[model samples]
Target: MTEFIPRPDQPASTSRMPSPLVTMIVAGAVLSLCMGLRQSLGLFLQPMRAELGVSASAFGFALALQNLTWGLAQPVIGMFGDRYGPRPVLVVCGFLYSAGLLLMALGGPTIGLNIGAGVLSGVGIAGCGFGLVLGAVSRSVPPEKRVQAVGAVSAVGSLATLVIAPVCQAIIENDGWQAAALSFAAVAATIGVIALFIGGKPAPAKDHSAVASNTRQAVGEAIRHPGFVAMTLAFFACGFQLQFITVHLPTYLGICGVSTEIGAIALGVIGIANAVGSYVTGRLGTRYRPKQLLALIYLLRTVAITAFVWFPVSAFSTLAFAAIMGLLWLGVVPLVSGTVARIFGLQHFNTLFGIVFLSHQIGGFAGAWLGGVSYDLTGSYMTAWVSMALVGLGAFVLQWSMDDRDRPAPGIKDSLLGTS
Candidate 1:
């Protein structure tokens, strides 16, 4: 009998390999563009409100729709990305995003504003946001470095805020808000083109035999796990905190008597600090349990919110809050995504994680909409701030209780008990 051996370079081999650095760079750029555009929405709130003659509630509703839409669509988009590859999804989402921006630029009454800015732009975001991009990155990079790669990708989103916020503000100030919207739309369209550069064709469809024996088993196993549930709920808090602040922080500052310039600066500061936070958290994730780190991050956010509420408003306080909050901002993303990958394997990470992220967006919708509604009702942000603090504490407790362990394989009594 002849001896059989596997070749080293065979595509079917299970050997681990590092993804090209260029893949990371491209992923970062795509994330940056997506996040930068999302964060820049705050800059347009006031101007759009004035030009369109819409109420705060109307603007808030539009933003709320955006968040809700993104949340609802994320899981679906992620599933498709996982099945079909991220490149096509990115391209399609880019076009929808640009169209949304263009519609907003046209200026409108409440219906148009809500539909364009809220619904259309949101759909775009769902397809292009962290869910799809991070999924791609997770597949490309080695398993050991997955957490770090997530951090790097998240850092790009933060960096986009740092660069794009100021640039959007300047455009609005110099060329006017309409021009700025057009310019932003142009940039978004460019992202569609850029997404074509990402390599890796989609995985081929699994045959019926393979699907029943392996794929179905894996999906069923992950769905029944307790840790996955905990991870999903914890991520809800992260979304609520980030979306509420990012959407309303600029407007909140305005209510406190801060200038537009200061508001923009505050956002820029948050972005810069967020970049630092992401980098640190990414590195720390390698050594620490992500659940514990999440608890700490939420605690810090609670402290930051309390301090901002207690302090008197000034240029100093504004910048201080920005810096402190930015540090806590977006730092949770890597850890959250990393934890999911750890407990549930990356085989169906995109689809599974996207479902988790959908919960986050639901929180985000509440945060953004409620902040505006509270302000409209009471003409003060005190209530909103108090609510944020309470939510932060809640998140701390939730994350603390999560058990970190590898999930058991299906149909194995010992492994099931081990997971339990």
Candidate 2:
């Protein structure tokens, strides 16, 4: 019998590495543009509803659909990004996102807010948001540095929120809401072009048996892992709190007789603090275990929410809540993604993590929609705030119970199922 021989062109390394700074910069710029566009949407809610004569629940439903659609599409998008490359996915996402905005601008009244603003925008976000960019970043970075890279990317979005929210408010003031929407569409289109530059390089093919096996095993193993399940559940609460606060906080404040300017400022403060928090967490992740950090962050959020509920409504309290909560906001992104990589290996990080994030978005939909529903039903936002506090505490407990060392490193265990 003749011996089998491997092809000369076969790849030696399983990983496709890029220059760290270059990847980070590209990821940051794209994420910033995407987030800036997203953050600006809150500015439109009141104006859009007023002009269209839609109920708050109708607008809420649209946003809820957007979150739901984005969550549902994440896993599929991750599969494509993992199989092909981030470039094509990013390009497509950019186009979809731009189109979604354009449709929203055009279909302001005819089809109702839910179809255009909710469904289209949600689909667009699924294509262009952190899900795709983080997948690419996860693939490009080394295992040890994956968490920091994710944190860095997440920080860019927070920074964009800080800067862009104010800029958007200014534009709405000067140009009117419609023009601001059009302007945002233009900026979103520009981001698509930038994504072309960042994600243009093709991922090199690999033939490593170990890497292939690990990728194949990752999904099933992660699904069965209690730590991963707990993390996913905890992340749902994080999403719920984040989306509820980001989407409805302005309106909630307005009900309390706060000015629009102050509301926008409160959001901007959160964004700024979030940027700082993400950076600090990312840096700390390099030296510490991310699981403990995640638990602590969630615990802080619990305390923050409780205080916000109990305290009297004042400028100081509002700003303080925004600052403290923002600091804890998105600090989990780096740690969660980093921990996934550490436990499962980078070969299938995108697919596995995408599933986890999908759960987060589901919670986001519930939080955003319920905030409006509860307010409309009771004529107050107290219920939503209380729910957020409860969820935050639950998240802290679930995160604390997760053991980081449950899963063995890739190739160290013979079978993925038997290791546990």
Best by lDDT: 1
Residues 268-381 of candidate 2 have per-residue lDDT tens digits of 898888888998898788777677788899889988888887878677788899999989988998888877766665556567778898989999999889988998899988
User: Poorest 10 consecutive residues of model 1 by lDDT?
Assistant: 4-13
State candidate 1's TM-score.
Answer: 0.89
> Which residue runs does candidate 1 get wrong by more than 4 Å?
1-19, 202-220, 409-420
Q: How well does candidate 2 match the true structure, expressed as C-alpha RMSD?
A: 6.8
Q: What are the root-mean-square deviations of the candidates from the true structure over C-alphas?
A: 6.4, 6.8
Model 1, residue 105: distance off in Å is 1.2
Q: What is the C-alpha lDDT of each candidate?
A: 0.76, 0.75
Q: For residue 227, what is the lDDT in candidate 1?
A: 69
